[model samples]
Target: MTSPYPPSTSISPSDMAAGAKKPTDLPQAQIDAIIRTKRKAREPKACYPCHARKVKCDRNLPCDGCVKRDHADLCSYERPSKKRAQAFESPAGASTSSAAEPTEYYSYDDIPSRVKPENTHPGPDHLGVGGRVSIARDEWDNVRSRLKEMETTISSLRMGLERAEESPAVGPDSGSVQSAEGASRSKGNSPEREGIHAANTFGKGTVHLGSRSVMAYILNNKSGSDQLQALLEGGILPKLGLDNESATYPFVDLWSSDMSSFDISAVCSALPADGQCRQFFYYYRDISGAIYPVIEDITKFENDLELLLAKRLEAGGVYREDGDQAQTPFGTSIAYLGLLYAVLASGCQSSDLGSKERELTSQVYVCCSYQCLRMTNFLSQPTIEAIQTLLVIGNVLSYNMNPGISYVLLGMTLRMGLALGLHVESSRFSVEERYRRRHTWWSMAWQDSHFSLSYDRPSTTAVSQPNIAYREGSQPGDFSYFETLCKVISLALEVVRIRMLSPNAHITFSSFQEYQERIRQIMIEAKPYLRDPQYCSSSTEHLERVVLKLHSSYFCSELCRPSLKPSAGRADANTVAMRKDCVSNLVTTVDAYIELHNISYHAARSWIALQRAISSAFLLAVVEEAKSDSHVLTALRRLEGIIAQRASSERAYDNGDVATSNITSSDQGMASYDPVTGATNPRGLSHPLSMLPLLRDLAPNLKLNGPNL
Candidate 1:
């Protein structure tokens, strides 16, 4: 080929073709290389609207500035013409595969849209995941809204109660409403008027919030500024790492004239512009004064409180059966229902958690126990319908995936079940007088007439009948009232948690150890207490009952069957005579309660075995008291046989050997949520050793089985 160049630079084709393979007349390779280079160099730079709107435009994806914003997703690049694209197509002019290989095409934003001066994003949830900086946003939005509504109801009722107290002209309805509100508020916030509003998230004392102690939240229709300040210092915008949850509502601090001005706008202002980065704090509570440590060395503080309530009952103490008075914080009927809901919530969520997690168990001991102490007013009222409603709320919350609320509900449920039993065992109240309290929370919430499995209502189901553990009524300090006593343990455990003294809890003689360790060492420390011949071979029993409160959608399932119960005579009516576990003296009062109500002999045996396990604990406590006063020791000495007999009962090891409940037609006490027990540790059940059985029974799938505790 002749060179195209002019004579000065031209060379003959023969002379230039030495290294060129075929001396091609055309430069097809040179053209392909140029096209490849151009394609590799392409860059997207459309417009700002396209970048922000997440759509690609002919102009480009994200220009240089979009890249600077760290939003790589906004980048759209320069493109080649369609003709250029055709250059790479297969010789056949089509892709052979039915489906194209998964190609990684970068997506882009829209072209310039209508411009606006307003902020690009709407409220909190306006942006896509790739373009936002949201942090631990309170997924409690729905909860917050519900809390707001509840607060409104509480405020109105509280006003009525206070006004009623101040004026005889106040009607019962107003007084009752006030009472209800006050109790409920106390549960979430605190009853301690002297404390600040939420200060710390992990539960601690005040942080000297920037303002001089001023009253803010309690002010009527307060400003958002002051509210923000308080919230900045307090509100617990309850965030538990879930989506769509509302923040924990800021509690009204009526007691503090020092902290003033609780404004929501201010609270919002306090929040970071990026709602996720920060959380607003709410409330200032003196945990020592009102909080219950549901999570502690303790497994079920509710059990202790229940025992205490039962003791009171045996002492002939009269409790309000159908009023707000039944709603006391530590062991109120209403709060008790909350405990039942908590139980169901945790039980269900735990099963649903897929791994049988113990998170709910700890939270139960800490968060749920607060009900017994904070809601004293409600417990005092004992409003049956009110108690039932709380359970329904628990059930509703149980469906939530939020573990925090689930934990709180579980604690509430345990307490509620016990309350049901205490009320049933209350001699001072007639069954009809408390019938309203007996209805299940589901029924109360919906007021549904058709709540049943088969034709029978939950309370009347055979398999759902009460266990026999609730049948005994013995003595003051007798462990029989364990259900009520659980409330007391709840209080004690809270005290330990707040004080950080659980580590110093006394387990045995001169032996101080962490409360949890002490609990773990039950068998070890128990050796001394069990050495007494009294606990061995004695038939004395410590019983407790379980009423399968829930019936499956079908009543015939194994979970709902009630087996034949032991036929024990009211044995000795005088067993109702309360023996003083304190110093031998005149009657402080007879404290007698049933041990087992309608459970099987084996279940009763398990209860009895548990008592033996804790025999040393009771003896240890009594012996310690004896050191201070020999007279007290004398009382302990006289009760040896009875106590020993109870211990023997605890030796029953029914684990897998015990039969599943059999639904006998004669079964009674159905749909009951209470459990009765004999060996009520005035200090709470021997460190929750019983929880082991419970954990086991409830494991894998727990909805069908009742736990050992």
Candidate 2:
């Protein structure tokens, strides 16, 4: 190709071929190269809109091209990124630097061209992959467009921030609103000041925030300042650092504080007639008393009671059928009366009396007991009478009333016993006193731990300090059974303490095995007592032992249940085996409880046994797999039979068909009623153990039978 313009030396091809004058000292090769080069095209310099539209733009504030189209304001000569970068950079100088020259600030329309350094480029799409700088044109354009939009948005934000910074600072006269600096300087800002500050800063839109921007603004504002202030002003908030729940409702004394003496005569008048009282008393003595040896000297109490009853019945030859008395014929001491009332109430519960009659009679006894308790200074020191009374009342409430309430009373009993230093073994006390204290402590501990387990909470009983073990040859009759039961209970309590009480307790296979081993040893120690040569011959004794053994197995089941629960991570083979063991134990427990009802079908029932039976049934029912097992189904049916029988009796009573009660001749007391022994006829027996509140809650589920039923 030939050059359009002549080079430094003009040499036409024809002239060069002719070798006519050498063109001004230029080499022939250079002349030819220059002539062959073509001129490059000029780069475009129009705005994107005009360029895209292919229109000629006379670039102006309102370009001629845009003005012609009636969209002059849309004529943006300023590139988006440059305009945004100027806005962002402008704010810092305006807000932060007093000495910044006004001219140094660039307006949006006057954004200076930024010089990018040589070899600088945006990051590659894939660095070093085939040494590529490859990017599709559309993608590169999209990225550049997004970058410009982000810059513009950021600049707008900076401008808003600059305006906010220029807003008036809160002054001392700005109502109750304190400056941020002042609020911080103050030792403690009362809730009032904090709330006022939040209102002034946030409520008034001091940050010049839009809806989208206000979220970050509000979150960064002082937290809960307004609510705290309101609570404080209302005096509903506790003092700083106090537990909110405990402070909200202060403790109120359960016992009344009148301290005035109660009329023993009035309380006695509330008691049933001599015959009825004797019936309740003798029933309690033989049945409940035998189980919990709360009575200090049973022989002397019987002798005194017999004499009092005989005199009361004679009553100067009045021969009154009602035997209504204005005063008690027996003792007037508050402790004795309290003990008597508690005994009567518990006995009535265990009797064959109709539900309405039992409830009413028991209530009267409970009131009388309360009256005597209020009159006496039982809490001053531990007395044999106080221990006996507390135990009886606690047992009554446990079996027939709310277990939660019973649990609370047990806590009180434990606290009272501790107050008397029952936990600390003492030689200063008599042998009888020491023994009584030991039993009392164990009773409270046993009750607390058992209920605690059911509640899935920690027991109040602390095994700190010196505790007494049952002395050999000291236990009368099957009292040793209770001792053994306590041992099992203690072990169960320890398991509960480890697994439930400890906040972060982890149950490992080794821990599970260790507990299983310990419980097994305890069970072995208890086995002989269950079939003790001393009481094995007596059916009543044997039954009591059976009940004890059943509870022992239940404790073992409880100890194993935690290990069986599916853990958070991978399953351990050992855990699976332990779970099988747990299920087997649970099945065994259900069988044992069900067998009790079968053996003593129409006998006086123990509330503890009922509770254990119900719990075991529930345990089986809950395990989805267990529902299909024949053993579980059989246990559930037996439990259903027992519950249905009780419900029928209750329904009969409700229908005023009291004569149809299941409390027949077969519904004998723990011991046979013998006139020679001063033992009264037994009524429908109630248990001494509190029924778990869970039973009532689980009623719907318990009533829900599987297909087998």
* Candidate number of the best TM-score: 2
Q: Which portions of model 1 miss their true places by more than 4 Å?
A: 1-196, 199-344, 352-386, 389-428, 431-472, 476-481, 484-709
- Model 1 Cα displacement at 361 (Å)? 18
Cα TM-score of candidate 2? 0.55
Compared with the true structure, what per-residue lDDT tens digits does model 2 show for residues 135-248? 344655676698799978866886675466445443333212234232322222222112223222212211111111111111122332233334223321111111011211
Backbone clash count for every predicted candidate, in the order shown: 169, 7
lDDT of 1 by residue, 313-351 (tens): 553453333355333322334344344333333332212
C-alpha positional error of residue 321 in candidate 1 after TM-score superposition, expressed in Å: 34
What are the per-model C-alpha RMSD values against the true structure? 30.6, 27.0
* Backbone collision tally, model 2: 7
